[model samples]
Target chain A: METNVTNIIIEKVKKSRISEVDFSNLPFGKVHSDHMLVCDYRDGAWQTPRITPYQGITLDPSAKIFHYGQSVFEGMKAYKDENGKVWLFRPDENQKRLNISSKRISIPELPREIFMDGLKTLVQIEKDWVPTTPGSSLYIRPFVFASGTGLHASPADQYKFFIVCAPSGPYFAGKVRVLIEEKYSRAANGGVGYAKAGGNYAGQFYPTQLAIQKGYQQVIWTDDNTHEYIEEAGAMNIFVRINDTLLTSPVSDRILDGVTRKSVIDIARAEGITVEIRKVRVEELVSASKNGSLKEMFGAGTAAVISPISGFGYRGSDYDLPEMKDSYASLLKKKITDIQYNKADDPFGWRFEVI
Target chain B: METNVTNIIIEKVKKSRISEVDFSNLPFGKVHSDHMLVCDYRDGAWQTPRITPYQGITLDPSAKIFHYGQSVFEGMKAYKDENGKVWLFRPDENQKRLNISSKRISIPELPREIFMDGLKTLVQIEKDWVPTTPGSSLYIRPFVFASGTGLHASPADQYKFFIVCAPSGPYFAGKVRVLIEEKYSRAANGGVGYAKAGGNYAGQFYPTQLAIQKGYQQVIWTDDNTHEYIEEAGAMNIFVRINDTLLTSPVSDRILDGVTRKSVIDIARAEGITVEIRKVRVEELVSASKNGSLKEMFGAGTAAVISPISGFGYRGSDYDLPEMKDSYASLLKKKITDIQYNKADDPFGWRFEVI
Candidate 1:
């Protein structure tokens, strides 16, 4: 979707936080950039989008989002290459997914023009916050929430859409450990699992907390019906590299159509590596691990780009993957970052230059 | 749970909106009471509860509730009897359910004293806001949400719990028509369907809106695995009276254990009516409607004590239930209200008098 960035109303920050930020000690989603974009939806139409100073906004305690959770969000990143050029990776994908999530959550679908225009303007304004440090970028969070003051079970009449950016480092510190969830399920067969919705993440916290107590940083969620098939690894889509073949679970109504996951599949196929997208069974993974065919297991999402899994625990047993000299995770992470930082050729034309 | 009301720090509203309220024309959840209770959870313990004027509380834009839906809430009411005494119906049940929801959503469990003391103090102080009109009460909403500023998938370190009251009339206006959902599911087996979490309600808004467009007031949500069994009607637990036996869906991980549903079952049994608590199939309900055995159908919840179902739409066909004098819904509504308003003997000792 083509966006007219000139339409954004700018309200620069009175006092910049850039001087205070410690780029070497950045935390994920804690520090905000100088400006944010706000758009209000009321009377069946979206108001003019405005880029304002990043600050707190008051909401009624009875807002539907507070009670019923009618909120949808998207996560993307803005990068600064070595040449000081600002770029956004696959932001159009995030805009499309946000509308899909809005439909699932009964929120009004944001126009592509507004989403793109707001995002580009906000990122351009906060370009300095785009850390030059490796693995760090401006983590852009564009979210829409119900803002009306009522407690009915239906959709809210008013919505507030905003694009907020935070300067962040890596999502995960290092190689992560995951637990295979057998009891608690993230999304159901006919539920809003595929949607990047607020409730979907909220429901996973308890089970995820339990996994954290068990010494795992994340959970590899299985199907709700039998817990026999793999679905996702925490918030990211999972991929299993068995020998020379790269296998990931196919996107379904219950699985998010991740941008990074799709990119990896395309990149692996382009690189002549075998890519299989199908329903992956838990038994198959365990057997492959036992037989030493499970070369590596990694998670793919916008936050980390490629989160290499060290090991996974399931049903009181742990399986560890041995270190490899040439791993797919490292290769793909390099390839993606190369295009993002403009070091390598953009074969897929995935990078969008902001300035 | 025993509550120590004397420990609450009360700050009365300086200027009450009592004179501006129109008791006879009350709308659900729009008008709030004068006072509200606030309790913060930080450093692993609940802070001292404080009562203040009903107003908006500022939250960081990066609060987990905005992005991850880490929130849970309970809905209840405080009825004013003809003698001007306020009474809470089985508040212990609400207190227990809130903590249960908290556990499911990874929000820290609220202490029994805090839940009870907050509710009692808020309702007592807002007694003037409780309408005298029949079918009207002070709607009490107790909610807990992740208040910390961050965008992690894990649970929040800081939380906020609030008890807010609104003057609301009946939740449902007249006899309601419902549609049997075939595609979208609210909750799944082994999911957080049993908890009154924000996500559970948020996920239903889209589907519920579709049902509304189809001229139905609510949707009778079916099981996620198969749309073969009837699970719930809107936000309430469902019951179908076939001949003499009152059949309702058994509480599972996918179905909320509603206070009014349980009360109806107990009241029906006490009145010598057979009550069957088991799995209720959709086919059985349609067949019962075809035959003469389908006596009545109703939804039970705190907001609407007993909402009678006029008809239901399923599989491109609509089935209507015949109106009957002395229907089970009416009988139970009167029975429950009688106990709630202190007009009859409290056989179950469910009433908790606040004044």
Candidate 2:
């Protein structure tokens, strides 16, 4: 059956697996929806998009993605309001960033129309998969990879774009303790850090594992050169609240321009709070923590709207943050989640209704 | 059938495709041989290895490799000597480095016995695929990637190790020009630059493409911090020759410990040429070029034994090196290739006989 949206071909699954999923207890990225959106790029153009059953893909062993890591992905979520309507939070930003990432890795930029049409159509078809539980939503993963079958170390001639949705709960359960990285780095000056490239995440796993071994949940990466400036936490943009003012590192070629990060800054400023986006120094954060000025720390991303960080370790020492009833993290998270779930008016026009 | 080496199960193809290949006109990595080696890591250990017909692999859409870039690879060559004997040049080095790369990325390491046995058995099975052309041989690509079916940003619970061979010619044909990069970087200070990680190569495609647009074949990467010190070239270790002395950067966390790079240094030093293994500054190179002290420059790697650089572009200025009668690149390449193909005495014991 053909849908009214952008001529996307639809092939529904014979049976839906919705009954097998336990909506009350959802793990992140484990339970995928019944249907997926797939599009192919060949002969210098993106071919027709299709919505098919979520299944395995076959590719030659010499496919470029397996060898060269020519892959890029975007993370998004669909929240079901109490009215059974679904809303997406600034999905246009993810679409734009996906193309930006593709261009950086030498993959052809995906047209915005294809991304949006395919995504919305797939979500509308699998609306039942969206969880209605508080703080649980359908985590959408839109990714593109080189499917060209060759080992030549250049750009590929064939590609595949896919959008898979998984019903997932919050990314972080409780407040996390992070370690300030002093040795390892996540990105370089003119690297793919700004883009949602696959390599950027792989490089962080080892360092994060080391931090986990040291009893921390994640590592707050530093600048590759000096390891002096606070960059971002694992898979999320970091924010520090000193007394009443908020501080975050300005987005650079070495840092991701997170949608959640921007929303937090905008929402905080709108609430009459000071939001300073600049190069955050490690020494400043440590001194602020000691002087009782560091009020709160949190990580912002698609999966976790605002993951409050309890404390941080740096240079063989641990620093704990004081608890507060009126924390900025809680305030910002409440605001963002309200907008995402369509419970509050989106003054920034960030929510997109799918139903 | 089962092979005697490590209990590897062997499955031959019903029909060999050797007759269809025009090996004399082979591209770098487009054509493959008849069989490949496969080993899986699951249930806390590596399972029995297998040799099967070269074919595509089936994987779930949410495989970690497609999302997080948990992949590593090694490049090698299998040469058939005049006496119809197959030989691998330093197979143990490739096996050891593969594990080092896996450990850094938190992937399970393949046992040394499995790697060696699988590689030799596969090569022996497809010995006819090893080209006999003067400058051509079978290009072996041994790679591992995360195959577990999940999209979580962590090390995969399952992995697949494969060895695929492509009968191909050299990577670079003629002398080429390179751009001395000042803005872009290939790796960070404490990153996976030393590993043959897939991300390292993917990060280079854009900068290399930009250099290609500027009429350069490759980009001579610099340190991420200052962009002052010379790192490696696109996928090969770089060497600069000043007068009769050879200079190359020492392997660090941000530079690959290339096998061919080490071989070149050892061969040059044994030939009574002064070799300096230290940091090569960009300004020092430009000064040497200006003073007419620079004799030659070349890149060393498994694919391209020695790729001579004709000239270099740095900061909008192009500098050409003087042509020489007795170039060091030609001398070292000949010495190394001779040892690899068993044309000369095995003084270094670099060759491993497969048959």
Candidate 3:
């Protein structure tokens, strides 16, 4: 059983595409690594995962993912240190969250061994793709979707889970301006908001496009019921710093329990900073901005790590946040990246070495 | 430009699979016709539409639809009359609704001519696949999804729109029992519920599975805010007959504007029945059930045409609806089927003949 679980068929690409890729000008999720990990779930059990060359796949027109949106995904990064050592930061959290999302979307749970082993094997094979440049890493996307060909609106009997890697620099630019959303909602209270489901992201595209037309880079989504409390900013969890207190929305079924957001909280507590997880109302944020107590605002996610909010637009007015020399965003970002790149002591044991 | 707009390259299947299918036991959305109509959108314009054999499509693993659910679809039917003529009921409404859904999900809108001509041509080519059975018809599904490779949480630069047909019998067997949902929600106010988006159906699978486990076939969804007012019943618009008046929830951004639902409303009003489109509260339903005012309940959709509700389960108690000799469900079902089959006069110009 152990051999069966660990036996992964390795199929390398004929010619590497690394030489053609410009590492300095890497676009987000555009250039893929040479190889990927693919696994099929059939007959109520997961088959042994295989390493294959990155390529297109054929699916029937009636595949459930195309019609029903029964899919979930996770995003993480692999960093290469000065000694050419590849490391993954807090991958166990991603595995746990993926299973949670799968359960909520009626997909079968994947064992942790498959996820870890697959990640390790694939990263080791494509270690050259992990850029060593500052503020750059190999972005890893692991997704599962219903591959069965049927139009019935039920849980599919067959599924495909795969992991693909891409060389990426940064998701956002230096700073971002966000619009406060009061009309369109991303997720409801008792919906798939907590899960990393594909449907949650698709619903936001139009609303985000509307915000972009209004000169905002992202939209800070509020609670669907009352549209009062802040939930998430774009695809990431938001944090607001006011009067030395780090405040973020509590993790509920309506808010995604972001790994970066949780790590920031833990790191802040360890560094003797007050962290409060509670309902952060829109009115409170507006008042704080008016009274000059809104010290900083940033978004936390695996893609951006830390996306600082330069200003926010509410109603018809724009409120600009003053720059700080020792902002919490910078402090937390440096601390996290230091641990990720093997430049600092690993206190919480979050690093996993690949090769 | 004229040639580009009207050109449709035809590619018929080498051998027809219709002989192998059992027309009596047709499954919903399983046995597809031999030909399909496909169109592509690229370079800021919709290319020429084409007719091709129903086969698998190759797509990159990073296709936007797989990760973000950037897809929309419409459902209608092709019925054969006794005189061997095929007719589509209210196809213009489906074309308009498909564009509406496309706009909400950030996909490019499909032209009405393309939609109409595509359906007409595909159904004309595979007209023999339309089952002549009383309860069977050729189910038409027109869907548009993002087919671009890269994934960046934005609308794709390319899209593929296609229409497929399947010979299907009734979607549900006999009358179905539904559970009143109070915990989970299908869509919220100011969301994508009004659109026939793929994400909307994907979210309902788990909740409907839970209801199935509890001896119910469907779930009666409620308002996301308070779960007080009834919204949609399963994938169809619901109607409750209370004391000679037909009551249903009014169309809103959170409620789907069902075509069959509209037809039923029109047929009911034409037959001198008082149709009230207002908020149907849960408490009012419970009271109606207890006081014997709830006469009949049914669901309206293209797949099922009209699904009679035998009874409903609320909280921990079951409410059984008494049988009626001339129930509104039967009358409306028969009237709609007659119009669909061309047995009755085409009073509303809802039927479009194909060859």
Candidate 4:
């Protein structure tokens, strides 16, 4: 793809931080690349995008983002193929979703050209930061926040858009246990749940912490109106495989429309698997667990790609799934990762090469 | 009242900005005082609180607060009475609620002594900035946000607490027209709606903007599940007066325990007016509005002690409230402000003197 890089202002770092980072034991979301993309929206338009050295940002103490949670972000990853070429998995999807989130939070939508050019230019400049390891990649964080100085309860007049990169290993280490939450909700109906709004994630930390204390790695969030339906798992969209059929909740105002989630569905359907996109009742899952039809459960997102679930706790009872020699989790993860890492054929045109 | 100012570190500004501010026409939350209080929580404890010149704060681009919305805040006021004495109305309540909001969002609870002493000392120093004009005062914003770098979608290890004051005029100019929102919601049951989390306010802006475009000043939110019951008005706790009785929704996990709300209830009850705290159905409001029994409607909060609603839009129809010669809104507002400004005797010990 030919990116319009002429419009983006580039300021390279004096010294690369790659030498200081120990990639062998990389932590998730801690280490950043040498440069970052920043754009300011003020005076009714987005300013020229700038790529500067990764550093701190200064804002007034009463910035709207600090008082009102008028912030939105996206998660994507850049991969390195065997031949040293850099690639981003469905970068357009992330750009689209970021604007969707921005609009929901009352932020002005970012222009597509700026988003694409800024992202591709930054990733190209820092292509060396893309980890060469088998399961590791450079995690890209594109976020926009209210930068207007005010304490009034309204939409901000100015906003700051940022794209920061972190090279890291997997989000979840291994197979995980999840608690089916009966109390507390991540999003509400007619709310900002579908958007990648910052508040959506903040509200989940406390409840997930409670689940972690109960010997669970994450919480499988249910609908706020009734705990009968399953919605999401932690920050990722969840999929439940009962017998030969795969089930996941439909995207609504209360559930995020994750990028990897749609890819998984498309890949699964192309592989001739039955995927049901509807509300999956907790009662059905509990019954399936008792009857031994629950084969596998997993979460899908940019950070994890596909995180297999080992077991789940619900209604004071723990249910474990039988280990399958030919589990769907492994098959789907390999297929998706193959596309992401540019190891397989790009049938769906999902890969965007940066270099 | 005596305060322990021994623990706080003070750094005065070289010169005051008071000369530049137009106190006669001060905008809400835009003109800030000369100094602000800041405290950092790290290494498993809150550091020494500092009162420094109000200035811009620098943070990492990857700070968790920018991405996850792990932020909470409180609204308060420092009122300068006729004798140049500053008083805070139920500041202890604001302190308690701030901690409550912090805990719900997984932020560390602020110690009571620090919150009290910091607020008192800061207000004392900036007392000259507090507007002595009628219906105008210095608005104090006490807020805490995640300051830790990294975006792994968990609770932040470091947090920043700040107290920024803005010398402002009244929040609302005149009676407002509110839209009874049935399509959008501010919060859900078992959600972070009750807390003054930044995300809660962020979600309301878009919906409120839509209402504004439709000729309404604010949105009267309804229950997320059914949209059949009244919840709140914009950022305030709502009250509906039917005939001679005042009806307000009970404080639950979804409704804020507003300081002004409770004060109005107490003052009204003391004045022998009937006050009912229960779930108020939208049907009841509509019926009362049709029957000419809906005498008054108002919103109560720190910014606006009482914002009277002149009319409301519901289901494609608008209902104009009668102009009562002696309305409950005017009466309660005067009684509350009397206590806040030290013009009336305090029977409930709601006023805390800072001078």
Could you say which candidate leads in DockQ?
4
TM-score of every candidate's chain A: 0.98, 0.98, 0.98, 0.99
lDDT tens digits by residue: candidate 1, A229-275: 89999999999999989999999888999999999988888888899
Give me the runs in candidate 4 sitting further than 4 Å from their true place: none
Question: Per-residue lDDT of B1-355 in model 2, one digit per residue for the tens?
Answer: 1245588999999999999999779999999999999999999899999999999899999999999999999999999889989899988889999999988888899988899888988999989999998889899999999998776788889999999999998888999999999998999888889999998888899999999999999999999888889999889999999988999999999899899999898889889999999999999889999999999999999998999999999999999998888899999999999999999997788888888
lDDT of 3 by residue, A216-295 (tens): 99999998888888989999999999989999999988789998999899998998999999999999998999999998
Candidate 1 segments whose C-alpha is farther than 4 A from its true place: A1-6, B1-6
* lDDT score, candidate 3: 0.90
B255-335 per-residue lDDT for model 4 (tens digits): 899999999999999999999998899889889999999999999999999999999999999999999999999999999
Q: Which candidate order results from sorting by lDDT in descending order?
A: 4, 2, 3, 1
Candidate 2's TM-score reads 0.98
Q: What residue pairs are clashing in model 1?
A: none
lDDT tens digits, residue span B223-303, model 1? 888789999999999999999899999999999999999999999999999999988899998999999799899999999
Interface RMSD of each: 1.0, 0.8, 1.0, 0.6
Name every residue pair that clashes in candidate 4.
Answer: none
lDDT of each: 0.89, 0.92, 0.90, 0.93
Chain A TM-score for candidate 4 is: 0.99
**How much RMSD separates candidate 3 from the native structure?**
1.8
TM-score of each: 0.98, 0.98, 0.98, 0.99
- In model 2, which runs have C-alpha deviations exceeding 4 angstroms? A1-5, B1-5
Residue-pair clashes per prediction, in order, are: 0, 0, 0, 0
Best of the candidates, lDDT: 4
lDDT by residue (A1-355, candidate 2, tens digit) is 1234477889999999999999999999999999999999999999999999999999999999989999999999999999999988898999999999999898899988899989888899989999998999999999999999887888889999999999998888999999999899899898888989999988899999999999999999999888889999899999999999999999999899999999999999999999999999999999999999999999999888999999999999999999889899999999999999999999999999888
DockQ metric for all predictions: 0.81, 0.82, 0.77, 0.90
TM-score of chain B of 3: 0.98
